[model samples]
Target: MSALFPTYKRFNLSVKQASGTTVEDTDGNTYLDFGAGIGVCNLGHRHPDVQLALENQLNQYWHVSNLYQQPIQEATAKWLIENSTGDQVFFCNSGTEANESAIKLARKATGKHKIISFKQSFHGRTFGSMAATGQEKIHTGFGPMLESFHYVPFNDRDAVKRAVDGDTAAIMMEMIQGEGGIHMADPDFVQEVAHVCRQNDVLLIIDEVQTGIGRTGKPFAYQHYDISPDIITSAKGLGGGVPIGAMMAKKTLRDAFGPGSHAATFGGNPLAMAAAQAVLKHVFQDDFLHGVTEKGRYLQERLNKSVGDLPVVSSIRGKGLMIGIECTEDVSHKISSLIDKGLLVLNAGPNVIRLLPPLIVSKQEIDVAVQLLSGVLTDEKASIT
Candidate 1:
C-alpha cells in the first residue's frame, strides 16, 4: 500500500521523534543516531538556534518564488560566500541540483562540453551528475546518459593529465569521496589536479556536497589541502536539517551564467535561508570547529582501540566526523547488528561502514557508539564459527 517507489531498501523502524543524537521509534525505543540523516543533520536534530530561526521565519513566510529579492537570501548567500572564500553562489534545492548547476556553469564558462570525473566518485543522481558520477550502478536504467563525460581512476595524476584535452570543459571531484568508501584524496594528487586545470585553462569543480560545512573538521575539506577549486558544489550540511544546496565559484566562473541562463524555484527560500544562516553562524565559530577536531580524534582513537584486534576491520578512513570503517565482512549485516543494539550506523557501499555523527555530538555519545559497535562486532565474530 506504500505510494513511494521501490528504489530504496526501506528500513523497518517507524521513527516518531528525534532529539540531539537519538531518534525514538514509534515502538518507543530510542536509538543513537550516528548517521545524522546521511550528513544533513550536522547540528543534530532540532537544535535550538536552528529551530528558533525556522520558527521565526515560518511565522513570516515560507516560499516566495524567487521574484522579489529576499533579504534573508542575501544574508545567507553573503554568509556562505564569506565562509566559502568564493565570489558568488547559485542556490538550489538538493545536492544533485547544485551539482547539475555547477556542471552546466562549468561547461558554459569554458565553452567546452567534456567533463573529466574520477572513478568511484559520486556527484549526484541527476542525468548530468549521473554521467559525471563514476560508478555504473547509478546509471543502469537511465538510458542514453549525457555524453561527453569521462571517468578516470581517483588519485591518478597522470591519468587525469591524459584525460584533459582542449575539448574537456572542467574536472570535477570530491575531496573525500563519500559513497566511494570515504576515501580522502591525496594532497599531492589534489595539487597536481589543480596544476593541470590551471595549465589547460579548464575549470576545477569540487563537489563538497558531503564534505563541506565543517563536516571534515574545517569549513571545507579543500581548506585542509590548501587547494582552491574554481567552483564548488555544497548541500548536505548547509541547512542544519532543512533542505538547501548551492554552487560557489571564483570570480571568473561566477560570471559564466548571464541573467536568464539558470534558475531554481525554491533555491533560496526565506525559511531555508534562515536555517542556513544559523548553521553558518554557529559552526563558523573558531571554538566549535576546534571542538570538532578534538571530538573527531577522540572518536577515531576509540574506534581504533575497539576494532583493532578484529581481522575483519581492514581500515579506518576519513577526517573529522566524516569517518568510515572498512570491514572484511558484509557491511549491511554489520549495520543491522549495530542498529539492533540501539546504535544507528550506515553502510556506504558493500564493505564501508560510514559514520556521520552530528557535529555537536559529544565524547560521551561517541563512547556509547564505540562500545555498542564493539559488542556487536564481537558477537558477530563469535557467531560466525
Candidate 2:
C-alpha cells in the first residue's frame, strides 16, 4: 500500500541515482533512459553545467515574489525574445501554466472567445490548456469544459480553413504534435494557418513545450516552418533539468495583461533563470544544434535500415531527436518486454513507441538501444504467429 495518490500509474522501480542517460535503481540495476522523463531531460540528467548553475544559485536567493524585477529574469526574458521572433515574455512554473498564459493572452488580445486547435494536438493539462487539447480520453469526467474550442483534422488546411470564422480568437497548435503520437504537421499546413491568422487578424499561438530549446535541431520548431506566431509557450528542456516555463508574444499581444491581470510567485526566480540561461547558452549554439541534426539523420537511417524488413515495424517519424517508431499490433507489445533488459522507452499513443533521448547521448547508446529493441521485437513477432 502506497501513501501517495493512486491517480498516477507508478513505475515499479525505485530509482536511486542517475547520470547522463542512465538511472540506477535501489537494487543497483542500471537502466538506460531513452524516454528522458517524457522529453524533459534533453541535455541529460543532472548535466554538469546545469548542476553547477543550480548549485551556485542555491547559496544565493531561491524564491522572491514576482513583485520585484529580478536580474536573471530580465536576462532570460531578453534571451528568449531575442532568440525567437517574440517581443516579450511571461514566465511560469510548468508547461501547463505557460500554456494557460498563452491561452489567456490569445483570448485577451483578440477579444474572441473561441480558439482553433488541431486534432490529436496536446497543449497541457491545466483547465485552459486541457480545453485546447484535442484528445477526448483526457477530458473524460472533466465536463462542462471551456466552450468554443474547435478541433480540425491535423495537416488538413481545408479543415482549418472551413473551421475559422469571426469568433476564432487564435489558431493554436503544436508545430510537431509530441504527445499525440509524434505527428509532424506539414509546412504548407502551417503556412496556411499563419496566412489565415494574418488575414483574419487572429493571433497565432504555438505550443512549443515539447519541441523548443534545440530539441528539434532548432531553437524553436516553428523556425523550421518560418511561420511567426503571435504568441508562443515553452517549458520542457528550457531549464535543462530544472522547472521553468515561458509565454512569449509580439509587442501587440505583450500588453494584453495588465500588471494585476496575471502573475506567478516563483515564475522567474534567480536559480531557475540561472539554470535556464546556462541551458540556453549551450543549446542555442549553432554547433550543438547542427550535431543534433546529424545525429537525427544517423539514428533515423539506422532504424530504417535495420527494421526495414521487419513486418511488425511500420514506420519511423518525427524530426531531430524526437523520433517515434510506429509499430503494428505485433511490435507494440515488444516495447514492454524490452524494459526487462534495462532500456526504458515510452509510447506516444497506443501504436507508436516514442524515443526522446538526451541531446548528449552518444551513438553507442542509441546503437545499444536499437539492438536491444530489435531483438525483443523479433522474438515477439515469432511468438505472435
- Candidate 2, residues 20-125: lDDT per residue as tens digits? 9998999999998988888888889899998998898898888878877688888888889988989988888899999999888888877889999988999888
Tens-place lDDT per residue, model 1, 1-385, is 7898997896778899999898999999999999999999999999999999999999999887877888888888888778776788888889999999989998898899999999899998888989999999888987988999999999999999999998999999999999998988999999999999999999889999999999988888889988878899999899988889999998877667878899999999888899999999999888999999999999999999998678778899889998999988788888887888899888888999999999999999999999998888788778776
For model 2, give the 10-residue run with minimal summed lDDT. Answer: 329-338
Q: What's the CA error at residue 67 for candidate 2, in Å? A: 0.9
Decoy 1 TM-score against native: 0.98
TM-score on alpha carbons, each prediction: 0.98, 0.98
Clashes by residue pair, model 2: none
User: lDDT for every model?
Assistant: 0.90, 0.87
